[model samples]
Target: MPSLGSFVLTCIIIAISLVLSVSASVGNIKSGPSPRRFMSGSQRHNATFSLTQIRNTKWEPREMSTTAVYAAEFLKHKVQMPKVLRLAWEKLKLHDDQSSNSSIHRRVDGQLVRYSDGQYVFPVTIGTPKQTLNLIFDTASGDFWVWSWLMPMDMLQNRKYYNGSASSDATPWDGQSWGATYAVGSNYGIVWQDIVWIDAIGVAGNPIECSQGVSNWFASLPGVDGVLGLSYAYNDSEKPEPQQTWITYILPLLAAPVFTVSLVHNGIGTIDFGFIDQKKYTGSIVYTPITIIPGGGAFWAFNWTGFAIGSDKYNRTNIQVMTDTGGNISMMPESIANRYYKLVAGSYKQANGAWIFPCKASLPNFVFGVGSSRIVVAGKNFILTNLPDGINCIGGIQSREEDTYVFLSIPFMQSIFVVHDYGKMRMGFANRTWV
Candidate 1:
């Protein structure tokens, strides 16, 4: 046997190694390729509560600590694209209310609106005393889940967790459980029936997944407590059985069975149910029928007739497109992205796969078609932000060859207003004006 000090030293070495291993694993997720990680697939709207206009629920989005923080934020997007596209080569794939908490948006007209770090969230309250949580309204998925007190200590990042026992209206539901596994890791939880309130009233006996385990990916995002799925078309693949989504419950209660999402760059935005805001956009709304994908599209996927760069005439290059409000940037086929970036002098693809250009490079306007209609995106939006290196800046749009469909996110959305029309099974688009 060895002396006591020698044994203790060996144990310490082993412990340190284990800790570093765990840390490096997480570091890889942050710096490398992982598919679009999802929080909750069951985020649907419920009608039993008062569903009205979301006034001004507010929370900050995840943003870089400083504008010049190199490419950590941009690199993650680049890494996710290849894996996501290779599978689609396989597939694919805000609110306002001013509240004191600043972390959670207060309930309003059934809507939550806040903007930060390029993520849009809505206000949702669960349980009797109304444990409010900030949830991202993701249309690409369908599942409703929130962080729970049951989460492991390490995974809990000082964020809000749903305490089901503290709520008077909480109960077990059908012995069901849900889990969403992602390219990086997985988050799983138990199900409970509780009253969910978005507006003033509450929808009773609604099933919500209380996440007992959270992956480092989801836990790393601040302010985003859960995901509310607006994609009524997609089923919750993680659930033990087919479950009803919140949108299915609330659709019948809507005046026109439609919802609109307006996400403007550097401005207040909202997702309103039942009515459209005419002031948000210019010209009449152009509608395109929802295009079903080859396998299936959980997102509000559609097609555009063509596009034009700067003063160039429109090119009739048709492609399928998907709208993802939670994403910080936009992506397209390498051909189109190359064309767009070429117009910006000094722009070049970086090792991480994102395009970089001089911070002061003149960017050309980008315009894409909505059927016969056309919407112009300002060139400035393409200049995402400056880099820590100081000489260059990252462009908002990136390119990948395997990208089967154009992925539009907050940057593309800043210059346009989008409507997800469930009533007619069509998607609408119109130009947005910041001035």
Candidate 2:
């Protein structure tokens, strides 16, 4: 009917219109308030079976270009919190035999510690009441230490502070012979030179041989006596490299491409290296752009959505939000919460405890303001069902401790994949289905 050129032009116009239409449809679907878009109720309860059936062992491992200009630009700096020393003076040391690969030794488990109000506390067995003391365990740095100074005068006179004075039940180190360094930072970093043979070794999971014992000064938390460095690469010669534990202990046995750390309340935690749990992975994996801090390693981060006290979507509310792997509960400003309570569908107490009454007619879903999008999380995901009414009334609103902060704690990580592919500066999220 029509000339060849005219017919071709007509086809092109039709194709363009189709593309535009399809794109618009997709954008609308993603942008729309598609409640429970990823799954139905029955599906959510049974999602774990789907997750277990997934074989994460299969991987066509391709090394990505870790160096990218765009990635560098997307990097966010690590949060530097003000920490002070709790115990007066504690000194600990580490050593390298020069023969074993750093990776193999990184898998050991030290004491699990908890942080609160800028202080750290953990039980230490030093063979006797006089020799033993409480210490702080830190993962941000490397270097094992104990308070060597400011000892109880009675304990000082009766026991040993690893000062080559008394031998209790433990094996003594011989650091007196080898060359060591005594380094201290203005922030209570300490290091001392000595050739000490470590009698017992501890770390995260596996313990290893102890050939030499060296100590160094470390910037520590306030009110915390000891610091346990879970960081990598103390020799300073290793770069563009993961710490020994990250490489040898964790990466070697991982069944999946990613791992998550879930630190539950009271220091009970689990580290899932390969996949997401079925219970938490009911929704689509949401990805937020993150900036990684180089050299300091990957600081766990996320796109901050606004904090929701209850189920009400706070997309319109402007609130400051932060995530802390170290934080145990959702902490919010009382002023903002007091005002928000009126709009929420719940009641509360005036005194010590906080509780919630979730109505079937309306379950609260709070939406957070991320980089560009609003992330809606239902109360079921944020609050526990076991609480009295399952809500804490801070100020006046029934606020469930929300994990909307940037630091993906163990419980929150159980709900999402917090992927940290170091140095590249980008993180990814896929529903547990994708994990």
Candidate 3:
């Protein structure tokens, strides 16, 4: 439970959300007679938009390796050094430990990798007059910074960068500097009090990180400007005093304290800002509280009763999974990965650490527990892509560096309507039917 002070602070933040009059993205961050009114779709569905409306122009697929995308994502969590290992947990413990490190003011969004564009990318407008740049909607990490005019001209090349000075409404955040150092690259910059807009909905004076210098890893992305971070506040990398992410500022203005991601492969997807879109998901939404762990404040860590492969018996092995959409693949226990591949004939582990199987092999469905619910990842989602030979294909689920930690990504997200409820510190999952 949030302390009285935290609840008060949350209300104040939501009050900010309520005040934003942007009619596009935010809708109306209304306070109903009943706080739970929007919890049910009978009330209103606000700010639901398809990816085609916000995404950058799609590019031809690039030649980067899929596992490289996975490795970059794997290192992201590894660098966080989460100390929680998947272990048995009683429902009583779950009830007690829900939302262990909930963000008081957090925001999230994402982008994808691969030239053929395996990931999703969207455009965001910043500054007074507005400079539009394409960015990844990253829900897991917490630094909402982007490329800026402060970097060397050669570094930016022809890529778009934010000119904060050009925005009449931009103001330098006094004495605040920030950095996001990932395994492959780093983005470091000073803070700005500026408007950050996702489509028509904008957060006024949101904390924006404008990078002075970024590594090749970031610059390599064709049209990406930066990340729109939507994780908890503690995960923010600001020094001295941390600032809220863009989504954090947006969260306060929501009709309900929630956001939903509906990811589809090779097709248009959608993101719901404040209300649940019944049209996107089916069945009852199963809720799971964020797991409790020391030194794991930076993730949406949750525990599952167990998982099963295809029609095989459901293994009630209690394991903790760190759900992140920033990355494109999933990583699980080697034992589990081995068992899964055993069921796929001619599957082999390549020197690159990714599992490959004949593209024609029949892959089984992957299912995991969410309370008593069984959420399934269809067999087709498991095969990442056809290799150059067009014979073998990459498997989406790989072996984790840590035996106890399982990372769930595309295979898990593509077919589900994921409700990230920061207010209550629980994640809700509903089966989604992609149109």
Candidate 4:
């Protein structure tokens, strides 16, 4: 009924109106409070997930024409239009996904309760019906594994095992196997896929390895059923076929590619995914670039500039250090460890391989540098516990082979709030506020 040009104009107007309407809807949804559903009964009490805002403001700007005057004007005004549009698009997509109740761009907080053995364990639910298990959230490992029904009955006594048959979403991955050898022990098992839930955030089709057998060291772990590794996906121990880490699969569903760990002594710690709690730490977060270990190890390795014991400062160059939540003691190079102990009078290495000192000895103040920031670990924190006789006390910092890398364990972690930035391959640390 209308001319070609008029009809074309009409279609264009309709298309633009539709796009604007959809965009306005998305903006409204993102600005409003998202609907939350809770699991009825005790399950609801065990897990409480909430979204937190991301603190980092860094953004990547889109490339623009060098000759464009408007581009220069945008830069002069400190407004990156391309980046802003990209962020808006991301928000729109995230809102659509959240509305579908399939995925969410929200920060998730998981409770970490300290165990008697000085290790912290967190809860992770697996499968369709949701079987919850307390797992050691190890930052050094790259595999998400659990003790399974496939193991011997005696070995499974008092230990929870994943019953794959009971999970409707469980899918077997035949021929895929994974094995990991830790300083404590080893575990081996078959790889499978299922829904893995941390707090209330569910990652469907999550790759998980169910351990068929474990060494005595692993079996002896108190109140731990398995490990949920937080290391990069490339470090997965699945031989012949390596799969992505659990975090990798869930990253897309998060608002930010960051996770924060706050460890408290003999108390409940917390792991925040997608955001950092500014209130948990003091001062600005100092970020240090990750040092990739030769041969590609999965540890959260970083550079250590130097260390100080009281007024004495020891400078180092290119020293690579790592943090592991699974380890209880901080292990440093033998020479450095000796030097540190020397600063504390009466501290000596015993025949039992422990470095012990008088329980009442005044320990030297210790601090370590990462980049431009210095993290001070109070000398009192280095004293783990006194002997039963209450004379000699065990030191938190111990000596390892000179070739062995330095490992910052629970003692060091407890004093700082750490951020593991997978997207940037950097580690950020800030002093934790003792409550």
Candidate 5:
């Protein structure tokens, strides 16, 4: 008979294999909620009319839930038990030797919702009385900004704006003028410091950019109030003195120096601060070193080994992979994009610079390697649905000519659980339970 430890290890290996097999089989089946419906006639009309007309229209708050589902797959499968047991034993020995030095860590979690525009927004409260606002939890950019009272009335149309005067906790951060430009639009604003709350935890004197004016693209998205940046401090675009990201200020308060995100398609996922929820993922979490950009850590990027589609594998000499929740589709090098689309029948590049194909065209599972681990994104996640008329659908993987970095956007992120480790300067990925 095998030793108890050996038997346990064998069982764990079998369980992990079964879980992976089941996940691979389920990839063929369509799951999760359908894509969001197109904008209403009234919304479309508002888009065409003047900003004043849209501001006059009363905007009712849509029912968006931020409750996350607890995944039971990990408990049922007993995946990663061997590693868990080893870690628990080590911790137990430490506790027995020095109980006073050991400290209990507290984890804070917030619910995240996938907006119609494919961005993940989480609930944030600012001010003394605590006014809750749905802000985009973006890791790509490092600027915490919100729609404020200073903005033009036309710009405030149908969106909630933070009124600093109404909150006793609000304090002006000098007369600082701040401006930031994203792929969407440019926004210039005044800076303010106030009590900001994420779930039950609150951060005092949190820096917030209150926008006074914005570009046309910013005006179009009336649903999103502002952005809560989670990137490093160096990525912050604030002029003169750079401000640290919310994660930086809140790290001391957390039990762990880590944050994890689980983004599911059309369903409520979660952002856990200071700890990783083993329940949300299966198997072991693969950790990859964070690649530093030229100037600084602009985004959570890592060195990508290569990408594989079915039997064909493409190796790259130098590749930087960055994950962004703010973006909808993945962007790769032009050559890679062309090669990927060629694999699908009837897929061709459009004059408008988009790769289009038959809506029903079958695509191979997109797999990318990081370190020694492979992360697989299902084919269903690669099809961008609800395009403008005539264009059936476009490939989710688009081509970018400028940057050497390949962007893994929300479409790819929705398939896995991502961990952003600040202390270790590493990013981790695991197979999501649902996928």
Candidate 6:
């Protein structure tokens, strides 16, 4: 048997290759959830969509379970989304000790959704009263911050909501007094108060207590009230580190040698605690040094090799790829997409809703390049070949989309065993069974 260390190292190598070797292509239509089991070779599924009317959507507070323990099973199977990228859990241990890490859980539509929103919410929290918060967890960014959405409005009058606003147990970023600020994104607009204070963030039930640098941006979305930022660094670098981010405060506290995440298909993934899972990995952990995007805080990134339509490679080069939980679709270059459609003898078509195409009975494989490496990956279905012209170009396809197709949403994360410990500053991956 391999030594424990050797076994873990081997697993990391396999995990990295598995992720990087996924082929880029489109596939045939299907009508079901994504496959929850892993396969030796690439597979593809077609994606379809229909807009659902938002009806009877209302908010009700679900009591946080008093029990701390929960049952967990190993995960398997995988799916992909084209235009939407498969996202990984952006993690930061606030205090560093094993016990300091909070189980990250998500409240989807209020119930213990177990899984966080794929691209909608962050499993993080902020404030002195320990106000629970979530964010668009972006691996490319490193700043830890929060926003206010669907706040009771009356809570604003409670004064406790503004713990950082009053500078009571709270501190300010760069001596700046608490005040309201505004910003915008691809989605909604935001207006918030900038404040600083300790944050108690939780994931899957694990909690971490630490100081944070945050924004009080507020919106009107229920179930999702605020963002939980996880950028490499904050917008203001001069601010004290604690006042800057929770990740920064936790990086130095880890006892583990490295970390990793498996954004598998289905709601069946795990974040390794002390080390990578040896049973699921194959070789040494592949380490690639990455340069953060100009505005990205410290999200890790790598280069993509090529994409293909069916067996023929699209032949585009120099594409960049990053695993992002903030993005909901697999995205890529439009030129590459055009080439893919041409190969399949399929043309992009505009639908009554989101434009779609005639998904061939045969699925085309898509590959993503990472730092001169390429990995073969599958798609939810063949129907949604690529994004519409105005939509973002995605070589980065999400696995699950419609019923039969696998979505690259948080559910896919359950497919792979993962860990992202800050202390090690390294990522690990493992192949787990969805069964």
Model 3 lDDT tens row, 107-135: 00111122233234666788778798866
Task: Tell me the RMSD of model 6 versus the true structure.
Answer: 19.3
Candidate 6 Cα outliers beyond 4 Å, as residue runs: 1-130, 134-136, 147-168, 172-220, 234-244, 266-274, 279-285, 294-297, 307-309, 313-318, 343-355, 358-363, 369-374, 381-435
TM-scores for candidates 1 onward, in order: 0.73, 0.35, 0.77, 0.70, 0.70, 0.48
Clashing pairs in 5: none
TM-score-superior candidate, 4 or 6: 4
By TM-score, who's the top model here? 3
Rank all candidate structures by their TM-score, best first, as comma-separated numbers: 3, 1, 5, 4, 6, 2
Off by over 4 Å in 5: 1-115, 118-120, 182-185, 314-318
For residues 1-435, could you state the per-residue lDDT of candidate 1 as single tens digits?
Answer: 000110010111111111000111111112211121112232333422222222223333322211111222223223334443243211111221233332232221111212133133466888768788866665655667788876776666567778878987677654466766442235667677777776643467767777877644355456567776677554554344546677766675566677877665554466777678787799889999888766543558889999999998899978988776545456778888888888888887643355778888888988999888998887776666555456777676777565477767656776788888887889999987753
Which of candidates 2 and 5 is the stronger one according to TM-score? 5
Q: What's the distance in Å from true for residue 19, model 4?
A: 55
lDDT of 5: 0.56
Q: Give one digit per residue, the lDDT tens place, for model 4 in 164-234.
A: 87998777665566765432125677766777777556765666777777745356554456767678666
lDDT of 2 by residue, 100-149 (tens): 43322221111111111211233333321224333332222233444443
Query: What local lDDT does model 2 show for residue 49?
Result: 15
lDDT per prediction?
A: 0.58, 0.27, 0.60, 0.57, 0.56, 0.29
- Which residue runs does candidate 2 get wrong by more than 4 Å? 1-189, 192-258, 265-267, 274-280, 292-298, 305-322, 329-417, 427-435
The superposed Cα distance between candidate 5 and the true structure at residue 93, in angstroms, equals 64
Could you give me the TM-score of model 2 versus the true structure?
0.35
Give the TM-score (vs. native) of candidate 5. 0.70
